[model samples]
Target: MHLYLVRHPRPIVAANTCYGSTDLEVTAEELALAHASLLPVLPKKAVLFSSPLRRCRELSASLAETLGCQAPTYDERLAEMHFGDWEMRSWDDIPRASVNAWSNDMVAYQPGGGESVLQVAQRVRAFRDELSGLNIEHAIVICHAGIIRLLAACEHGLSIPEMALYAAQKPHKIRYGELLVVDC
Candidate 1:
């Protein structure tokens, strides 16, 4: 199966804000640019899936219209990692001790009382499992960078801890509106 993982367009937010699952907005101009860049490269008639967040949902909807497909199917597992108390807060304002603790144990640490990397990986894996069960040969998933990296880690057979470390180092990073093609 072929999977195309797409990151949402750049969000409209204050500088240095920690926003995951915070329901942030994406600007119209930026979203149109994303559509123009991605629409041509995507496979025609591919199954479309997206996180329910506004950022991702907007892209999905636009793509659906351009491709003449039905609205995308949203899966909660595709949502960004929940940052809990850190959502929409400035990163510098978050307690240093909490940040340090997360750094110490990236795989298991639940920062801002939110889901750990391991937890997010588990959900991503579940979504992958569901994807495998589908009979389709190709699909497009519009989601967050975190989940995209988690899925990439899964493809490379990396453990949760290794994925955490790898993500921290910024390897195989996906910029906003970027598409990563994976064969499973």
Candidate 2:
């Protein structure tokens, strides 16, 4: 099945910084944007799922209602990376030493109270297993960029650097997770 892994729209935060697992809600304007733009074109056969976070749930709930399906099943395993101490901090504010540390060991390094990339990947793999046994064929998993990046890494065995690059890519477009099927 061709899964439509939809990402949540932007939050009302000030700048574009890492807000992993943070509880930020989308503004009314952004919500309207999703309804006007993505809602009409959403796949009919898609069953919705969201990370437990409010941002993802907001997207998933609207899509599910539009599709006339049941409310989404949320998975904490699918939530964004636990930013811990850096939950709401700006990237520029984080000391360069810490940034360099994360740069070097994205998979292994954990910030104070936060999780590592590899740790999140393991959870993504677990979520993949859970998804495999679910009732739906095509799933629309609305989640954050960090979890999405780790999902890509878990499926393809991408290195830390590659995952980092993936996260830095253009947002909104689906960064592929696992290939649900191979044509060959």
Candidate 3:
């Protein structure tokens, strides 16, 4: 199975905000630009799947407008890592100790009471496993950067720990609204 892993467009948040899993609103103009940027690269028809977050859901809707595919399937497994108490807080304000812990062991550390990178990777793998049995040839996953990185890492046969490291490497990290294609 081939999936087009698409990160949601730049969210309208303040700089340095730690808003993982927060339901931030996305502007329609941003969504429109993302749709236009994607139209050239996206397959004409494919099943659409998205995180329930407004950013992804709104982008998925825009894609559906051009692709004319069925309604996007909202999957919780595709959500960004939940940042718990850190949600909407400025990144600079998060405790130094917590940041150090996450940097020390990114896969295992759960910063700000949030899920570990490994935990997010596990659910992403679960989503991939579910996709394997489906009858579709092509699918588009409108999700977050973290989820896209994990999926791309898995496609390269990286272990969970290695996946974290892989994601941290410069080239492996995806930009907002960027597309990463992987075969499941």
Question: TM-score winner among the candidates?
Answer: 1
Could you list the CA RMSD of all candidates, in the order they appear? 1.7, 4.4, 1.7
**Evaluated with lDDT, which candidate comes out highest?**
1
User: Candidate 3 lDDT, tens digit per residue, 67-157?
Assistant: 9889999999999998778889999999988888788887777888888877888888888778877989899999998888777777777
lDDT of 3 at 13: 99
TM-score of each: 0.93, 0.81, 0.92
- Measured on C-alpha atoms, candidate 1 has an lDDT of 0.88
Instruction: Give the Cα error of residue 13 in candidate 1, in Å.
Output: 0.4
Q: Relative to the true structure, how large is the alpha-carbon lDDT of every model?
A: 0.88, 0.68, 0.85
- Tens digits of per-residue lDDT, candidate 1, 80-102, equal 98988999999999999999998
lDDT of 2 by residue, 15-99 (tens): 8576888888888778767656666666674777789888778877877888886788899888988878988888888888988
Arrange candidates by TM-score, descending: 1, 3, 2
Off by over 4 Å in 3: 168-173
Better of 1 and 3 by lDDT: 1
Instruction: In model 2, state the lDDT of residue 181.
Output: 24
lDDT assessment of candidate 2? 0.68
